[model samples]
Every structure is written in C-alpha cells, then in structure tokens.
Target: MNNFKFSENIESYLVSAKDIFISKIASGIKTRDELFTSLYNTLLLPGYFGFNWDALFDCLRDFHWIDEYLVIIVHEDLPTLSEEELRIYLHLLADACLDWKIDEEHKLEIVFPESVRCKVEHLLSAD
Candidate 1:
C-alpha cells in the first residue's frame, strides 16, 4: 500500500478503494491546537486521545476503531506552525506511515496538494 503521496487528483485515489475512509483537514490550521482539534474531529479519534504529539502519533498509528480498509488523510495545506513543531509533526507522520506498512488488511495514506509537494518533500528530507 502507498504511504504518503502528493496529488492534485484525489479522486483517482478514491476510485480504486473498495472500503475507504476519507478525512480532509481544511486549510488555515496555524497552530498545534487547531491541528489536533481538526484531527480529533475529522478522524473521529477515541476519547482517550491526549491532545499532544505522542497522542497524535498513537492515534494515527492505531486506528482499530475505524472499519475501513483504506484510510486517507488529505491535507489541503500545510499548517503554519513553528519549525520545531512542524518537524516533529512531519516525522510523526512518516513514522506512522512506516508502522502501518506491516498491516496487510489496512492502509494509511496521506495526500498533500501538488502545490506543496516540494515543500513537503523538503521538510521530510530535512529530517
């Protein structure tokens, strides 16, 4: 299964999945609080969610409550966070993508718009 990808045509990704859960994170998420709230509401994270980086990573990796075969997180735009926060967030996502790789029955995919493809790649590579 694909991990993280950048594409303008999100529909292409949706068309092939038999069972899919799509969560779109709207634009203008400028702070960690906004990001977490958006994730909690959009992904329907469990009540045990702890509103922190570690908690976000845990929720992203463990989606047992979701029944869909494919889970896709579509980021409309990058959050305007502090450099350190953004780095941590990106790495957490990369690590979660790696963890989800071993799940044969489930897939976690993150898609960013093509406009920010270069920025995302640069941020990820800076790690």
Candidate 2:
C-alpha cells in the first residue's frame, strides 16, 4: 500500500500503518479485548489504559506521548464481532484516525480478514 494515497487530505498515513503492521502487531488475535491489549502494549500507551472501547478511543486520540501514526493489523482468528459491535469498533477507530489529522501527527489503519476486509473498509470509508 505504499503508493495507495488516500483522498486529498489523508496524506501518507498508510505507510506508517504498513510498517507497524509488519513489525509490531502482525499476529493472530481472537477478541476485541485481545486486539486492544496487544495494541496498547505495542504502542506502550499508558500503564492505566482502560482496555475498553471508550478508553481505546481516548488513548488513540490522546497521543501526546507517542507522536507516530498507529496502524492496527487484524490477522486471522479474530473474534466473531457482531455487526453492531463491529460497526461501533470500526467507527471509533475511524474517528480516531480522522482526528489524528488535526495535527497531522498520528493516524489509524485496520487490516481485517479478507472475508470482511471489504466490509470493514466500506464501513471506514463511509465515515
């Protein structure tokens, strides 16, 4: 995805996302909580990360500590998130990513299963 530039304003966020996926979080995760913990530990956010959806959003947007963009790689064995749950999680991530653009300092990306990649991408793109 090196040459995959986003819209006029998105910039090169995907490059950092791809690097993070290859180096840090390219594992087989099963649950949303697992994903959250893995990302939290990878990014080394705060010791008191809430490890919940709301907390995740807060930590992602509150990246005053780590100024790098955040890219989440969701490999196989991901938990069976319901449609509603999936939408909520993706929405939060998408929101965090967009908010990062305010300072052009951080961003978020998610690579889901091929089965749901299109669906998830559609959801994020729709935002």
Candidate 3:
C-alpha cells in the first residue's frame, strides 16, 4: 500500500472497501478470515494491498490458530492522511487480535514471515 497513488478508479474502490472492512471490524460483524476474503476480493487493483492472507490463514488453521489484519493505513493516503488516521488503522488490527483472543507473544511469531513481514512493516511505518 506504500505506492497508493493509484488510478483514481482503483483508489476510489479501495476507499470504499476500507470503509466496509472498518465497519465490519468495528461492529463485530466479521471475523479475521472474512476480512481477509474481502481484502483478497479487492486485490485485483494495482497498488491494492495485495497480501498472502489466504495462504497464511490456511497454514494457521491447520494448527487451529487464526490471524487477522487490515491492509489499509492512514499513511497510504500520504500527505492526505493524518498520523491519527494511521493509528486508527493500526488500532483496528490490534483490536481484532484482542477480539479473537490471540495471545500477543505467539502472534508475534505467527503473523507474517520475515521477508513479507518486513515489507508490511515498512508499509505501515510509512509517513
């Protein structure tokens, strides 16, 4: 999501899709896997937050573990998004982990693998 300067059409779609995922996470209407499904569905767009959430979840599920996250960040909007917005996006992901009762320490071990995790970390850290 770092290169969010996408075509207006792609950005527009993600703008709406972010809202959908945000609302679902907020209202307890969606689970971690459901959120990933919605995200994967929208990933056809270039500059979209394309992730291996499905593959990761499949691996975790075999161990009876689950993971959840949101690919959007306030930072994705660049100068348009405030630090507050970035925190909000991150906060939502944290809340989902809490809601699902994921143990923090284990989650650290389970989320994204090193190479992919570093990229995602850089994306989220973008100001």
Candidate 4:
C-alpha cells in the first residue's frame, strides 16, 4: 500500500506503467448525496450500492469488477459537508486503504490536490 498523497510532481505519479483504474471526482460536490452520486458514477459501482458510507466502504474494498490492480481516486476539490460527515468520509477512506492492504489484491490510492492538502490532513487528524 502506498501513501495517499501524491508528490508535488503529479505528472510523474500519473506516468505509471502498470494498469490502473483512475476515478476523478469533479468539483462542486457540496452534499453527501452528490458525493455518493459522483462516486457511484465515476467508480461504476454495482447496482446494489446503498448510497451510504457503509456501502461505499464495502464497494471500495471489493473492487472485483475493476480489472486494474491499482485504483486511484482523485478529488478535484473537497465537499462542503458537516464536520461529522467529513470525518466519516475521511475515516472511510482510511479504512478502505487498510482493508485493501490486508486483502493484498488491489492497491487503493486517494489523491487530493496540493491546494487542499493541509485542510485534508487537518480533517483527518481531528479527533
């Protein structure tokens, strides 16, 4: 499992030779519903998706439908959710990363732009 943050040179990170599945969450996601919808569409989640945090974690940890060994989720911008929801989202990401590490079948990487890196780190570190 690799670190979540990409180096300052994202171009180099994007130059991987291995097969990878990349999903981009476009900006302007202000609500949990929008975030779920974007993830559902971008990741091509199964119809059984419940559109909730648990469902997201389940689907993210079980990317059996995706053939690529490396899965990269790039967030164009952070969502405008309540503190609790944001904390849950970040924990979900960290949990999924840990789950993938144990599974050893796929690698999950979450990338945030440099502009919001500090904010993201702060949120993740908050108790």
TM-scores, each model vs. reference: 0.88, 0.60, 0.24, 0.87
State each model's CA lDDT, in order. Answer: 0.83, 0.57, 0.33, 0.82
Candidate 1 structure lDDT: 0.83
lDDT of 3: 0.33
Query: Which structure among the candidates has the greatest lDDT?
Result: 1
User: After superposition on all CA atoms, how large is the RMSD of candidate 1?
Assistant: 2.3
Candidate 4 lDDT over residue span 38-72, tens digit each: 99998999999999999999999889888888888
- Cα RMSD (Å) per model? 2.3, 6.6, 14.4, 2.4
**Which candidate has the top score in TM-score?**
1
Residue pairs with colliding backbones in model 4 are none
Off by over 4 Å in 2: 1-23, 67-79, 102-104, 111-115, 122-127
The best-first sequence of candidates by lDDT reads 1, 4, 2, 3
Predicted candidate 1 versus true structure: per-residue lDDT over 39-115, tens digit per residue: 99989999999999999999888889989888888887888898889878888888887887654667788887788
Which runs in model 4 stand beyond 4 Å of their true positions?
6-18
Lowest lDDT 10-mer window, candidate 1? 9-18
- lDDT string for model 2 (17-107, tens) is 4325321443455567777777787667798888888888898667666644544533332345666666777777666756656456555
Error of 2 at 53 (Å): 0.8
